[model samples]
Target: MAIEKKTIRLLILEDSQNEAERLVSLFRNAGQATRVHRLTGIDDLNEALQHSWDLLICAPSSEALDPTEAIAAIRRQAKDIPAIQLLANNDSDDITAALSLGAQDALPQGEDERLVLVAKRELANLEERRGRRASEVALREAEKRCQLLLESSVDAITYVHDGMHIYANRAYLELFAYEDADELEGMPMIDLIGASDQASFKDFLKNYQGHDGHAELQCNGVKANGHSFAAQMSFSPATYDGEPCTQVVIRAHSGNAELEEKLREISSQDLVTGLFNRNHFLGLMDAAAERAVNAGQPATLAYIRADHYASLLAEVGLAGIDILLTDLANLLRSHFPGEAQLARFGDDVFTVLLPGLSPEDCREQLGSLLKKVESNLFDVNGRTVQSTLSIGVAGLNEKTAKAQEVVNRAHRCADELSEGNGLKLFDPADELAAAANRGSIVAMIQQALENNSFHLMFQPIISLRGDNFEHYEALLRLHNPQGEEITPLELFTAAKGAGLAEKIDRWVILNSIKLLADHRSKGHETRLFVHLSSASLQDQTLLPWLSVALKAARLPSDSLVFQFSEPDAIAYLKQAKAITQGLNELHCKTALTQFGCALNPFNTLKHLHLDFIKIDSSFSQDLGNPENQEALKTLLTSLHSQAKLTIVPFVESASVLATLWQAGVNYIQGYYLQGPSQSMDYDFASGED
Candidate 1:
């Protein structure tokens, strides 16, 4: 619904400009907004046919243009426009000839009312043909994507029609101990399950209609070798090879102690710095708050933030930042003794809980630690990078009943402090003001949504290799009442807090698809990478809604790549996997953005099949360092080995280009290429090697 009404692009084959204007005016009189392009000769007609048009109107009696030749030319190009021929006189022979030449309808010239009616009819017919073609293309693409996903997925997957295996992926064939897909071509669905659960599965399948489909069961799976293993099988309704079928996904269940330990570590520890994650840190803060209220114990929480963190990231990259944080965490661990907790509280910010410490003592300890951090030159890939930290202290007392309140206060004070000050104590007034400011932002987002005031910006994703296609990442921008653009971070935070993230995502998807479709109609092979929020990933209706949107826009499924952050995909692994699978089934591509930072990044990839892996921007910061460059090369090699394309972002310098190119990266993007712009005008061909 983003594009409430469609504008018809009409191509007119007429020697006289005045005649073309007159025809266009008739459509306008009928309440249509027509964009008309008049062709004076065959050369112009041939060039114009490359662009998309809703309808083609030709004056048959023009001296320079022959109606039969024009219709034949349009047909030869295979352009799906409803061609209407205008005859100066109603000669039955001429009319029949025009129809034979592929004209949809022939009308007499100067019959204004009849011409308008015929034009509207032809335009409606054009829309219908386009819609039908789009749906057919989408269905075919969906089947292709499904095949690719199944082949690449680590889990065993197969499609069953009438309880017989019609298709199986490599993983399924290998899992069943079969050498190839042909070995399991006609296997019954019940043969893979244990005898005990066979009857129950049959009963379940008898009532399955895809509407009540998604179900998982634990059962013993029998391999081709007759060995049985405990497996978890999930069933979902799917269509494969243009036939109705059920898709079965199986994963071996293991009770390995090491895997459990790794899972626990991932849940509690930050993958980069090996410190407590944000959730675990908040839990510690809550316990500290309870102790302060119940036992009357004094505690202080210090929020440490890297000053100008964005600039530092651009300078050193994620690997460099990781090294800096690891060294800083070591210093904090040594400086603070037992009963003190340290956490990497998300994105260049660290938190420390000091129990049994007075407010003045907490400030004194934190100030000394800050000085130590500032004075030390951290070794980031053999390059000494000097950085400063800003600290904010908030004391827990009997009056502080909630831990989040204390955390918010500390963050507010940290934001208020200047870089020169480097430290600040939490002020109650600042907390109140911050709350009021957040409330205002939430209201602004709601108003903007109501007014349909959000817009999209694009940044080019340049290919390191010679890829002729133009690719861009679509970014959302919102305008406030003052008509100034609000940053995406602020806008998303407000939308999430207000429980409107899903709505915002839907808006972005619809508008981006419409815009991409229109752009492609202009003869550009453009692809858009649209980011989705966690809410959209978890929404059950998103896939079906996306199908309708794509069909209406007539855009190819592969043209729009849906992306989400690595952390979101990991945190909501089940939902993310389901969404990704569904997207694959719909023939759309998927990308995991801000990747390579998780403790076990590849572990998530093993469960969900993806087409593109966007290396976290952190990796781009220190590519100048040979050590960092080697690390990046190794990561890209691993990903390439898995048949996954790699995209590295934040390429700000020419020096880094050689490193990324030599690393065998598939795509690279940064301000050096171009920043986000309102238009998709990046000269991809000019940058081609």
Candidate 2:
């Protein structure tokens, strides 16, 4: 396949028939026996270059065989052909100057030493051109072969020139809907494409002639049935009928008709769920992001993993998963309107893009939407099964600027949030936030071990009658060197978002137990309560870790209350229930801190045996908002029969306290009791308890 430099040939064009004949004889006169082709015109010269002529030696001619025209023609047919035009007798300097114009040889058209040397030198240049052209041709042929092997090609292939179709492949006729190869002849190549795509196709063609721009590209091509599929094509300007033209190759991905489609995507689709294969869906998400950027929009990526999909999948394998995906996909399509791109990412994770929507708006909607999805049981293989979901949403925000950056964040958040299907929305702002730098936050927690930035303050849980404090809830704070103490509100929430919840929660628990014991040792008895993040349950070591922390503080299990929110409780309901039940066995108490969430099942109360349920602020706000008061009273009374329920009315004013007394909430815990008092100085907010 590799042609040697010695085997190179040259096309010679000359106006002087005798001189051209003599030039051919001189080339043959070479002791090396090199090949020299004698042509009279540009057409004949160009035609000879296609089959490996290394050089084009042109001489003055009368008609189409003129050497000047021959050089241009050779350049067009094969731009890499080394060409040298010949001139007449060397008349002092005029003859040599004439040779300088186009000829590589001079000397009165006689075969001599100078002519032989010139011929040999030009042939060497021709070899270099041949190597360059061969490389380009090989690359084109390889790409064409790849096109032929594509199971899902969209390009049509044709070998023709001068508005005539010399040959058309099956894909070529079928893609353009031409009845036969002859049908495509005498027609412009643009006619196969739609009016809109024609101009773009032509522009692509024009660019291809000058540059290597004809790679993979998509356009629309008309079909015989008057329908069309997006055609992805590539072109290479090559030879046909010894003339200048481009050989185009194209493929049609799928047809417009659903039944006649190339890929049976529905089979690959998980019916009950509507996610694609693990491999397929991730690729789809990446592709969707690419499309989103092209369309000038901020792409939102979400990974939804069902907590109990494995049990469902195991119970009913392929058949069941299919029904699940199909149903889920249909539901998603219905909920999201106007061409929302959906990719069934994996078994439990179905990715989607709501492009152009702000992260805040999307977060609120996904928060509500996922709740609806988790509120019911899905029917699978004649068995009704329930599963909660942990959905993580990530989007192109200020910090998460790129598509992959946002996607990786979203996936990582999903992993953090997947508390047996519990949803986690990861914020890039959590770590590198405006209030705290990442280095300092981590360093502060580490340094807290020695300097005691970790300290607990108790907010008195006053009784309804205001007779005495029922107990004190342990709250945490961090004191920076500036003397401004940061409350748990500042760092705790942010830490939980950054996967530091386990360490912080454990630290708080140990410190709280120690503080409670110390207070009791000073003859001040107070029950200790520590808050836990949803992330903590996923930590396999949390229970054993808690047991050790409890023993070290010499605190009775019953004196410790583990506080958790209703949404968090419901999200990892199975795990939450198990932990709560275990705590009960150890005689420890558990309270739902923010109970009665908008979407949580009050029915969950009947299922979970609890020590206490703190009605959410929404239901206890303004205690006598009548609707709220009555709702709280009914919920409390219902719980009173089942368990000891504490209706903690968060009041900040006298009116709220009076309303709570009338509403009959059992306990009050809020700023109205006393602000989170500083340990160094009890310069709390101006309030009377």
Candidate 3:
């Protein structure tokens, strides 16, 4: 069956009535059902603008109604109507003027095919603009309703931005003894805290910044009457008036712990199924994630969706579906009792959180529930409706970053069920396998190498030994057609598979040298650490080519440090040794990066006498571990003994400075000093002083 499209509404303003009729006929002949109205004068256009319109066509000026007056009339009425002008002849100036006067396009007379094609495009664009306007209106209405709900809510709520209250609900105002919201507006939230609690509140606020999830603090709140009362404030991330802010809900502290628990339970329960609501279930997930990531505990989340929900809803109405959900919730409650949180996550999906359970154990338990649900018949208002489930299980461990990720993974697993009534576990390997196929990345790199469109980013490597020399690590970046940056790891890996690694290396070297030469011309003595791939290490032709390029750029060879990773050097040790010797012959410095990962780290250094040895980032990341710190110190000592200027990468904070300085490391680099940018503007003189 072919679907029918809506009629295109057009408004035409022409000096001759015959031309308007012909225009309508042309549209009809082009297979478009158009309902058009003819405008004779300004009054006619004003009246026509009151109704919906798609496209407007106007004829050349004849002292009656020209294209200018017709388009101006449409604009004055603020109508989303696209206007096209018909010129007497194909004069370029006339077409340009018509377009400048707000016409979508100006077609010369007698071009019926071109006019029809342009009209179709204008009609499509008009429909899209109208749809967007409708959506904006609907969004405004929804925001209004939400504002009304917030004002009438019993919970005391206030939105705070940078510690000042931007908005407060009626309950929030009353809780603080303010007569009106205006009295509380623009007031510092810390002023509401008692003098003794302000310091602790400030500390809590500092820790809560940029963190998700919710936090609660028990403190004393000062009322307008100069009385202090115990208040429990809950903070969560929220947005107000399209600006990100923190939402604080304050409740009076009650000593009746049991009663408080009962109130919390009532608020968190769903009316239809008596299970935990979506918001409360998400809160439990957050707590579970905190335990898993911080305490090394294991947990599992299951997203169970009732299969064929639309068909089931059709079979048993809304009331019957409620009954079915209640029955299913009860069955789920029986299976997951203690320490297991069950929630009505959505209309047809139920979530189960199994804490302290391995993925294997959770799968076994869910498998039994799947069988029970399949065998049992759900009685919906005396009508039996048997349905199955699609369950997705995701494990949460020390590797889990947040709770939402687990929920999303679990939901994705459930959605993978083609025939319904099955269980699947989320596997990290699947994501890795998908990411490994990067044809788009290879294409982007190839295009960049061909067009010389790759961008070079520089991060300053500051010296800790009081050396004032400016050093930057040259990084390569490739943005896809969509302008999204592809990471260096993914970019190079793809380029290598496509045999473009050596080309990319040469491109970086040439560009970096050019940039360095220009920068040095400005009287800044700067050096760049340019990286090379494994393919470049084996390419014996690279050294000779690099010499000619450096000489052409009039840049000193010592200004560039050609760096290759330890893994690459280990894989091609003989090539790396030869490359190191060749770079030395060219008077260019050499650095072996990501060092100390091999079984015999010093053995590779024995063959390749390098200028700089950048220790592996693992040593820096694990500095908190005492053994790792000792390992780094030991590695640095051995390198220093070999006259190798040791540099520790990933110096992410000032806290690691004292350790690195005491360890006698020569230089440091990471975001703490500077991130990769297009400019080499780091102040080496000030830092050295």
Candidate 4:
């Protein structure tokens, strides 16, 4: 079970590069050569795992990554890649718990002697597991399925064991003129043969032994009532009930009579693309996955989806896109060379496998291919339809070792990076670095939320009321290392891209609670709102984090309003509904942000009894424009008539306030009141309103 290699590619997700380097040296000295990449943040982890690696060494206990979180990320990306947690203790209980947390082994970080031994043993186990997965591929095809195709044909078939009739299919019994199945089962092999053919049949049985592949013999069979009939019988060696047996196919006439039926029985390939259809493709994908594991090679499939293909189909018609798919398929076959097993995955997506390749090979080739594919374009009916291939590549490579997770990760990356016509590859390591930074940002954002670098600035909410002190909204901000101030939009966008979205949302919620506490303590408690992110829409439990934060601050949910952006709010409406219902139970105020812009969740406000609708600033930008102004006025009147809802119009300029107020907008927010501050905790320049 020895790993066959010079050394395994390993990575250390340690914030300390020195510690990572020391382990790298130890692995090299211990007969394992490797290139170790060090991860200090969650963002760059994706880059690290876009390929395969032998192992990942992590120290969540040393504040590098929380062991559980890191393990989840590892399983998501490199499922088969083993992870070893460097524990501070050699205690058995700690080791057992680490194993349960998905760590392959827990070894003391500064140890000598057995460290190399432990690494070797884990590597061997990894290889063995990979081998077992490989060998079982052929047997996974359903036995009943094979029997169904063989027995259901309208042809004579009799199974012979040691020259005695073991069984006969219904077609075989019918052709023999046997009264029933039992009459066919117990009869001697010679009984079915014509009396004149006994000697020749014996020769046929003897010659067919140990022979493989196709052969047929012309013969005569004795039917019931002593009738003789001419027939052709085909013999093949096959396994039945764990014993060797001979398959006999006898027809009333020549074998040519059954040739057309045989062709129908072998139906599999997809007709349109001339590739394996769905059932066959899935079986092959499974086989390829097992083969990769068995052969100890990295495996991945590319979900090459044709972006904007639907619109192209609409414009150019089906015949054009059909030729386009055909041309694209030919391009894939040529470009991938001899590496991948290609298949049409239905719709505009096609799948291919690069099986039994090393993790390094798998990664290098996919990366090189992505760059090359950037310039490749497709032509539809002589029209160059500027179409791009947005691919989601998933595999048994380090970042995508499992079947389902690989698919999910690839889809997520493709969807997020669709702005570019070129391929955008993803590795979880990229997300891990950003996630790691979120823990630090959470602490910093909470403390300085109301201070100079972080304070709540008032933006005027102008509507029918002129510059009313009664209404203003709060925003969050951050300061970069370069002494440049960053808004919540910038900070949150990076976090969302890096998958630190949930953590950032948590930080905003907890800090917002603290802001409410400050306002209540100063006897200036007013409704200050914080916007919820689309990513946070999935986190139903984050609402409970606020309950604890509010209790800690000795404030009620009534002092705060939870604002949901229309897009995020509408995307996962069920999660949003559950969240809203929970907040409604707490008597907390709820409002929809960018209300007019959200097409889907815009409907939620009418049915869910939503409290307020923030007129999206797009209406403000186009207030003077005739088309936009009419749309905004119509929307304001309709929402007011149906719900008489409080409308907080987000105006970006003092110039637009008078026009917006005359347009029937109630509350307005603009630079006239002041811009958003860095803090969620402090209300800056109270007299500005």
Choose the strongest candidate by lDDT: 3
Q: What value of lDDT does candidate 4 attain over all alpha carbons?
A: 0.66
Please rank every candidate by TM-score, starting with the best: 3, 1, 2, 4
Tens digit per residue, CA lDDT, model 4, 189-225 = 8877887789998887788886787679887888777
Clashes of each: 4, 39, 0, 23
Question: What is the lDDT for 327 in model 4?
Answer: 74
lDDT of 2: 0.63
Predictions in order: lDDT: 0.82, 0.63, 0.85, 0.66
- Per-residue lDDT, model 2, residue 219, is 84
lDDT of 1 at 103: 95
Stretch of 10 with least lDDT, candidate 1:
1-10
Give the TM-scores of the predictions, in the order they appear: 0.41, 0.36, 0.42, 0.35
Error of 4 at 229 (Å): 66
Model 2 Cα lDDT, one tens digit per residue, 1-689: 01222444656665566556556544432313357666755556556666876666655345656555665565555365665544464465755654555544444444343555665676666666667789889978876775465424444577646445666776677766677767766766666678888777677665666654346567887876788778767666675544666666776655565664525576555544544555565565566566655655566777766667777788778787777667666667777757566776765677777767755667776776577677766787787766666777776533343466666667777777635545566664443332344335544555564445677777766566443223667777776646566655446544653456678788788777776677667655456567777777556677777787778777778778888766566556687877887778777888877775423347566556677677766665655467777887777777666756475746677777776666566777777666555331222222234
Candidate 3, residues 1-689, lDDT tens digits: the string is 00014567778777678677767755543334578888777777777777887788877764567668788877887777888898889999988998998898998876765776677677667778878989999989999998999999998999999999999999988888999888878899999999999999999999999689899999999999988889989999999999999999999877787999999889999989999999999999998999998999899999999999999999899988999999999999888868798999999999998889877787778899989999998888788789899999999999889899899889888988979999999876544333434436766766677678899898999898876468999989987766788876567656766788889898999888889999999998888999988789889899889989998999999999989887677667899999999999999999998787655789889899699999878789857778878998999999999999989888889988888898899999999887888889888887777
Off by over 4 Å in 1: 1-18, 27-54, 60-66, 87-101, 111-146, 209-213, 255-269, 272-689
Q: What is the lDDT of residue 182 in candidate 2?
A: 76
For model 1, give the RMSD to the true fold: 28.1
Model 4 ranges with Cα > 4 A deviation: 1-472, 486-490, 598-602, 644-650, 678-689
What global local distance difference test value does model 3 have? 0.85
Best by TM-score: 3
